[model samples]
Target: MNEENNLEQPQETLGQALKKRREETGMSLEQLAGALKLSVLQLQRLENDEHELLGPATFVKGYIKSYCRELKIDSQAMLELLPEHVEPAKKSKMQSFSRRTEKEANDSRLMLFSYFILAVIIGSSVFWWWQNSNQNIEEPVTTVMPNQLESSDISPDLAVAAPAEETIIQPEADVPTTSNETQSQVAAQPQTEKADPEHSEVVMHFNEDSWVEIHDGNGDRIAFGVKKAGYIMKVTGPQPFNVVLGKHQVVDITFQGETIDTSHFAKNRLAKFTLPLTE
Candidate 1:
């Protein structure tokens, strides 16, 4: 009976086990989370094994590792249970990312189609104007026959051959402008500083409290501190940014107005990404 009871002892979950160990050491969740340098929600999710709430799902292992470190738990013992919590999330993330890629491909196709149609319209307009302008140009008037001139010359005043009226062909100020010329002028216009396509900037907005470290690819630190919820940060530097976030679920990152998808790193619950994959 004793052997059976020992064998049947209920096992504690990852969260419960971690919580138990923390309490044994006289530590609070907030304090533990703070010690881990992450948000309380992140610690809660880790304790509860709320895999669904963990962003990028891939970072679960990373966050778990950090949490285990904070509690001074045996990493190998806890990590054996990690696969069970991590696999389902990996599958879900794959499906979601695939769908997003499909949508982006469709949007790109639509934009290309629109540009093609616009080019055809402009080309046709230019061709039509060229044909019409050539047709409208006045041809030189042939000299009147001498016989015909003499037949109509009954009046001496009319025979004076009125000082060959000058034919000044001044270009009309109100002449219709061709689309081709307009397009050429627009293409030649210089772009402003803000309008440069390659202009680089990194911006991050936090949804909740999180710790952040901003650095360059070469490891030079730029900014490091705990940022509060709704905190907005913009960075521009001599190097590409390597950003590390304490928690990523509520954080937003952008490069020149484009939203960056960092879901792949969400599993760590902490997020690390480079603004440009290459400097």
Candidate 2:
């Protein structure tokens, strides 16, 4: 009886045992492959026990463990069927090594891209700042005279008038007058009008005769005059008025139309006012 029972005990290769269990369950090789999420070729290699096609012992052991569980076979019995010298595939080792290499390569590419973007931003910002700084630099200023018919208009004759070092003359006595006299004259003499001490003086000198017009801040024409080289006129204003001289000359003066001789006064007689007329 003991000899017969020993002969009845199952003894088979790993591949044969797996094949027997699969056939007993009426499962095709394709069905088993699908259930294991493996390709048909992979399952066929395992069923045939092809050592050359098998990757590593670890992969073989994992497959055996999973297949045994799914087929209701004992995992210990399946493991016992494998030869001691045959090793299963090590899938995790290869996958971990590949993943590390791929991650390093991706990190290097990202670092290079970051550096490139930073350099472009810094270079562009520096170029823009340089251009802006150059634009802010001021240019040399040149003076020009107007073509209006007023003593206030700076002309070519006035350009060559007095030397810069000449001392100005303040005549106390009145000069002789011509035939054109009016009610605006002081003491019936046109030249006897004295400068008001309370008002500030704004003298304008010209080379030739030119027309002068005065306007307020609201564009209202306050006064007009035709003046010669040494002609002097005065206007009363609480603040500086907009004095438009000739066709080009424009200035703001408190009391305008007073003239000075080029021989006695400074050559560049045009004064720079506080407010800039041109932008």
Candidate 3:
């Protein structure tokens, strides 16, 4: 019976209680605002009972609680002084705004997913069409007439003529040569044998641009520079040659008439090796 009577009695509002406590503590609004890390205008609005100007009922309740704590009073009892309908009216607009923002984000994600699916479908269709077109183009258009088929099925024992054996006349072992031919042969023999025995050829066929540097056993720089694509370079140098290549995959190196497989020796797209690779 006493609890009901106490509930029926009019109670001091939260703002009025907070203002009375602040005055009892001998603290100005500015001093309290600085202590609570709040602006003086917000403190004034809180003390003056301006809940509408404080943004939200939740924030207003928080400010009241902080003010109660600073004054060393019961924050829960102070919070209970707020009207029951205050939060419902004030928070409705915030809840609606939050819901609207969430809806917009969801819509954007759905739209992006729809575009991705559409692009995938379009790409798949194009690929399928291309495959079909290629198959259609590759198929041969061939037809066989009945008369041609009958002609092709001739009797095997009707004495079909065998193709005439080619006749190849064999040359005599000893053929007399003219004076000019004998002299030309004699001159060509020395020219062929005149190749330098001290030098070996290092050939590089470049399919892409690559920088190459080469040094022979004699410490002579035989080749150095950036070789362009499709350029075939041949350097004749002494054996046990030192070679360096920028972008080893771009160039095919052939030493002593054999292509070297230096791709495995490459590191960071560069290769360094010696010609006539030792065991």
lDDT of 3 by residue, 1-279 (tens): 999999999878777888898899899998998889999999887777777778667788788888888889999987887765354554778889999999999999999999999999999999999999999787543223211112122223211311111111111223247688876776666433324434577788988755567777787777655555787877775677788776677688887778888768644445678887775
Candidate with top lDDT is 3
Any idea what lDDT model 3 has?
Answer: 0.70
**After TM-score superposition, what is the CA distance of residue 150 in candidate 1 from its true location, in Å?**
17
Largest TM-score belongs to which candidate?
2
Query: Predicted candidate 2: what Cα RMSD to the true structure?
Result: 16.2
Ranking by lDDT: 3, 1, 2
Give the true-structure RMSD of model 1.
45.0
Stretches > 4 Å off in candidate 1? 1-9, 23-30, 39-41, 50-65, 72-100, 103-107, 113-117, 120-124, 127-131, 134-279
User: Residues 1-279, candidate 2, lDDT per residue (tens digit)?
Assistant: 999999998867788889899999998988878888878887777778774466677777888888888888899988888875354345556778899999999999999999999999999999999998888664322222322232224365443331222112222334335634533354564332323332333445444554455544444444454455545444433234455444223222333344322232233343322111323
Candidate 1 to truth, TM: 0.34
Provide the lowest-lDDT 10-residue window in model 3. Answer: 161-170
**Candidates in order: C-alpha RMSD to true structure:** 45.0, 16.2, 23.9
**How do the residues 7-50 of candidate 1 rate in per-residue lDDT, one tens digit apiece?**
89987777777777878999898887778788899888877878
Off by over 4 Å in 3: 1-197
Instruction: Indicate the residue-level lDDT of 149 in model 2.
Output: 36
1 against 2, candidate with superior TM-score: 2
